[model samples]
Target: MSAEPPVSLRELRARAEEVVTPEAWEYLETGAGAEVSLGEAESAWQRWRFRPYVLRDVAQISTSCRLLGHDLATPVLVAPTAYHEPYHPTAELGTAEGVRDAGSLLCLSTRSSRTVERVAEYAGPWWLQVYVMTDRDITEAMVDRAVAAGASALVLTGDTPYVSRRARGTALPLQDEVALVNVQQHLAGRTWSSLEQDPRVTYADIEWLASRSGLPVLVKGVLRADEARACVAAGAAGVVVSNHGARQLDRVVPTALALPEVARAVADQVPVLVDGGIRSGHDVATALALGADAVLVGRPTMHALATGGAPGVTAMLRALTAQLAEAMGLLGISSLGGFDRSLVEDVTHARG
Candidate 1:
């Protein structure tokens, strides 16, 4: 029999933990070093107090928006997380279908177990998240394949030169468990160690990737205003203010805290997005108020997929969108454009 659907994100994670193996659970939950950044990232959103307007017409609310020329039913997008196969039998296909059904979008990871072509068959509007490897050919080939397979854009992960030392170690044997179907043939008898992310990657590489693939590239893992500005100068089509989900570094600034500065740096030259610790529609509104064009949810998507596969993911996306619409109505804002810095204020100190 299928498992019961989750009623809350916390419950959803609890159910997923019950089914996922101990090692996989640790791999999924733990962060680098002391995990300080990981723990703080989630709570950072709560510091923002919404300044809602009253007496405004809220009879019609629309959460619809466009990103990089693609229309979305909601401002929420599925952030790229690797190896969905371990979470469900359907894996990325399940995620693709769920996001498509919800009229949202998916960002497929480079380390995905599913091939780009296969996912494209099941996905709606999608983008490819890339990790430039030691073997640049492998990265380029995959990007070319994804472009051919219908990827609308490329999201280049700027953090993570190498995987950080997580607080908890796991014995999941990722070499065997991960199919890496997208670039397996390109392995060319090379050692797995040889394929580690190239630490030498720089701003110039960002321009190269976009020019080579003929697709707009959004640099992810940015936290500073200067870095965001550099990315735009280097021809990045967008900027994602993320701390690599707080997995790459310990004690780093949270995306919520970093977003406004990064957004201001770009000056709307490109779309700015924020992820990490986004839990509800209120947080979505908070992010937009802080200058994000949209928000991305990572772990919750995995939790939902693990519990009930495609339906679970679809339900989760729909629930969040519904909450966002409700939040818009309650805030007396009728559209996505209504969100601004004026809508939120930092209440970290005056909470009393």
Candidate 2:
């Protein structure tokens, strides 16, 4: 646990550094190739300075938000991540508990150490994030399992259609501890010779998974405006414009830059959310004001958890939630509906 009192996410991140492996730390911290985009994501967040308006009655404040029919205490959802056990033995379950207790949503990853069914046993207003495999059977089966396990939402990641080529720290060895349970049965007869055939995404993958899931399915990893339109037309309830946190492709536009176009393209056809370098509650406010219905967060939470475990994650959320409320109160936003395009003025020559 962190000896220092955590007043905000920054404190949680500093504490997380003490417990995380150097290799895993780099894995979470690094961006694609030369890491220019990674820096840009940070720069993007920093560039968007807030215009605060004081002298309002903020006696009553609410951070409540709804995604796919589930109301969140805060719009902050736990972005999908794999193998929490590496950071804490309780792994994704601990993450679920944190999200549940925090009154936010936990989106369990397809690659999670805990099976979807097992993770579902924890209290949730949760979503299951799935990787669409080339094999229709596997995709269909994963959807079936997620549905049976009582998952309320399905997030299909479209960004990571292939393995990432970026350079990062050494991959933490999860072979001995973490196993992918949902696809394990289908992988039994799969051989190295057939490995090329095992990618978890295909046209049939989308069509098949949607056929089985009665819940809302969100397509993640979208960047281009045309692709955003396609995802909605293909029946996505929402789109999460992301470049896999700059982990997949280097030099891609920062997640925030790509969001406005995609959000415009979708045009209420579906809600749009984005993720890449979001770090704070003001970042969340800025994202909403620009166009996103919500935003996703990844590495920061892990950074916090790696530093402080449950308390670290708890403190991080508490600070972000408080900061978000403060941002809103300062912005004179009595509710989310009040945030609009006029609220955000794009800074020229500023990092996007």
Provide the TM-score for each candidate, comma-separated.
Answer: 0.95, 0.90
Error of 2 at 282 (Å): 1.2
lDDT of 1 at 282: 83
Give Cα-based local distance difference scores for all models.
0.87, 0.74
**Candidate 1 per-residue C-alpha lDDT over 1-352 given as tens digits, one digit per residue, 9 for 90 to 100:** 1122324677788999998878777877888789899999879999889879999998888989999999999899999998888788898999999999989999999888789999999999999999999989888999999999999999999988888888885645455536667777788777886578999999998898999899999999999999999999999999998988788789999988999899888947999998998888788889988899988999999988988899989888888888888888888899999987888889975545
Task: State the weakest 10-residue window (summed lDDT) of model 1.
Answer: 1-10
In candidate 2, what residue range of length 10 has the lowest lDDT sum?
1-10
Across residues 1-352, which tens digit of lDDT does each residue of candidate 2 receive? 1123325555666777778777667666776788788778867866566655567666677878877788777777778986777787777777777777778777788878777887887747888888765555666777788888888878888777676766764576677336555567666666533323345464445555666898888888888899887777777888888888787778888877877788888947777888877777788888888788777778877876676666656666666777777778879886676677666766764445
**Which pairs of residues clash in candidate 1, taking residues 3 or more apart in a chain or in different chains?**
none
Q: Which stretches of candidate 2 lie over 4 Å from their true place?
A: 1-6, 51-57, 192-205, 349-352
